[model samples]
Target: MTVTEELVRKRAEHNEGEICSLEELALHQQDIEKIEFLNKNCKKLRILYLQNNLISRIENINRLKELEYLNLALNNIEIIENLEGCESLKKLELTVNFIGDLTSVENLVNLGTLEELYLIGNPCTDYTGYREYVIATLPQLKVLDGEEIGKSERITAFQNLSKHYKTILKSQEDYFYKRVCRFLSVNVQALEKVQAQQRRETFSKKLEENNGDIEKIAKEFWQEKGPYTPESRTETYEFLRLQKEQESQKAASFEETKPRRKIFFAEDGRPYNINEPKIEFKFYEEIMENEQYFVLDIAAYKNMDTSLIDCDVQTNYVRVTLRNKVFQMALPEEVHPDKSSVQRSRVTGRLLVRMPKVKSSSIIEPQNTKWKRTTGSVEKTESKDKMKGGKSNFLTVGETTASVDWRNITNAEDSRSGDLEMQKRAPVHRRKERENSPSFVDNPDVPPLE
Candidate 1:
């Protein structure tokens, strides 16, 4: 039944003062949208059951400051918000919801008395190390998603959380890399071969920095490849250098056979080289607080003069030049070039480019896009079908006439191309410090004190 003052009074009368006030209410499966009627009526309410409803948000509950046990299971709630006033709540049921981020759980951690939290069947449960993350975040949580949090489990979760987080990041990186490769029409095998050579070169440089000390390098390699002798180390280094040289030669041969396209010049009159080294940076495009941003790091080129840095922003392309290094890529989304700003950090050498989004109602027309020029630029032509429909004329650069989706081309310049497994195996410098600290699982023979 719909929760009303009349219904609450009727129940109180029928129970012979047992339900003296609307202190406890069971309004399940009522399809109720608003509970404004219970604002002043349920002044002494401590328990509330509103499960199996169509409630999409947790609002209008600020008046329930005295509420302790709140059963909100089986609702359509997407975010864990609007519970700032529930300081007295101890047990909160939020199962079968759409909570996807762990930060939502962090928000609930502010409720110091929240001992029992049910969050099963939520989208966040599918996250890697979900249980461990929740356990680590809310140490006071005794029962989590119907499972009791043991002392040993808590210690293990805290110990392995960083490792699990790294795994999650690697998975995201792999997804982005695959998307980029598909957008660039680049063969995955060819990219992998190039990356392998780059890794070998990096290793060789590190070895040379150590003054070719085979004994010292052997100690570092022992953990990964078992014991290594000086002869084995020298042989391995030679093999890597040889393999890298061979890969470079093969790439050069392929480029020679391939028809080279003409170089495109930036709006600033600087010709962009197709064979130039790709910029060493990481970037992500995101929309925040009604504004779009293209954040990127250019710390690798810190030695370059800041005054020499030039940026040319267009609807479909963004060309950033720093001395000899140039970063030119097609933008993924249409943005207002007039509302963009570039800022460089002197300490970390990172660059932040803010691009405000255009109004949604504005119509964005596709611009004539060109890549590395081939033979020559041909005249714009229209077919019979294009003329009848009044479509844009196609521009021919080389022998092919096509309309390119420049947004997809932005993924080709990603610098983080390392394998996920290789990145996971990277040494953690803080691991030793964590191990030296006391833990509940330090002694297997003794039971946990908690």
Candidate 2:
């Protein structure tokens, strides 16, 4: 039966006060859909019996400040809430109801004067050590589920609770570590594929929600996941966005700290020399008048003396050594080994080499030649005289020419017959003119005129 004014009047008559001043109200099993009328006329009421009713909420009781005893047993209530203002409450009965977890007990902890609490026949009671947990949580309770609590029981319950929580935390940590390792071990390509598929699905869902408006979807996607305000949308969305950002940051940090492996690619014919200390040097080449010149900048070896520098030059290769470093390079073309020159600059620490071009008629021969000790010497080979059948004599000033037949000048007849015949005739005329003249030619080997 629903609670009516006649029922309220009948219940008030059994109490020790008038209808308006009644301190106790037993309206159990009355199918009360609401408690609005109770707070309007029952201002002085302290004890409220709301058991076995259709009430699904524990609200609208805040105006009953002096309320001490509240019986909400055997109701359809799904959550325990909105009882914060019942400051004078000492006993609360919530037995045989739909409360599912001990999380609801947290709200009741604010009841400072509460000493008795009953939660029997609730689903939360099915959990192991639920009674101990409740007692440890609500230390002010003298009786829990009709059982009296003692000091020793409270201490034992607290110890068990601490151990249980520590075990849970450790298990969670281990599970998380294992999951991280597994995630890292998965192939990156596969993971990226999965992520792409998930993004596609999310995009499809959003497109449907926005009536396939691509522009609207794009705008929504690019919008800042948020600087959340009190008026922002669902808390779950905010939480997920923050979680995604944190995960991205963690991934970026991991990549930053991760070590990179060094890779070297070797050419088909060129193998890296492990024994050689890696040093970079500059190379230059020039060609001039049948010669090739090369200069190597070995400035890194500036600290070494000239004597410590070593070089080997060949017809088609060169090898240099300085301190602990060695460099070997193959010449691009064949060169004349006998005419090649190698020198090092003391002031600039540069290595200069000249390799003459090999003549077409000559064969290049390999020679294991080392650099000469002299710093600036150029090696060259002199060519022999080319004229055949011609004997040339060196003549000094005031020396007489040797007598010879002018007709025997076969090669000179074609090129210089007139000039030679004039020379032959002029010498005779010079002798006669000299003899007739008074002044004589003065010579150390000749007798002076008397």
Deviating ranges (above 4 Å) for candidate 2: 1-7, 15-19, 162-450
Off by over 4 Å in 1: 1-20, 163-450
Q: What is the TM-score of each candidate against the true structure?
A: 0.35, 0.35
Report the lDDT tens digits of candidate 2 across residue range 1-450: 345667788778776436677888888866565666666677777898988765667877877778899998877565678878888888999877756536567787888888999988765666566777778777889999888998999999888986554544454456446545544566844774676567668877875786544555556555737322211222323334444665676678888998642321256543233225455666555455545555444444555787776776666666666764566666565566677777777676666666665533333322333222223443222222532356434333343457666667556546687777678888453434435466766569987679
Candidate 1: deviation at residue 332, Å?
99
The predictions' CA RMSDs to the true structure, in order, are 43.3, 33.1
Q: Model 1: per-residue lDDT, tens digit, 1-450?
A: 245666565545534544435567777765554455565667677888888765666777767778899988876676687776778888999987655545567677778888899988876676678788778878888999888899999999899888776665554456446545643555755765576577568667766786453445454544554222222333444554555665676678787897644456778855453424455666565556656566555554667678877877776567777665567666566677897878888876766777665544332322334232235775554444446566766466566667678766535355553454467899877634444645545668888688
The Cα RMSD of model 1 versus the native structure comes to 43.3
Query: Going through the candidates in order, what is the number of backbone clashes in each?
Result: 2, 0
lDDT of candidate 1 vs native? 0.66
Model 2 residue 135 lDDT score: 84
- Cα deviation at 49, candidate 2, in Å, is 1.3
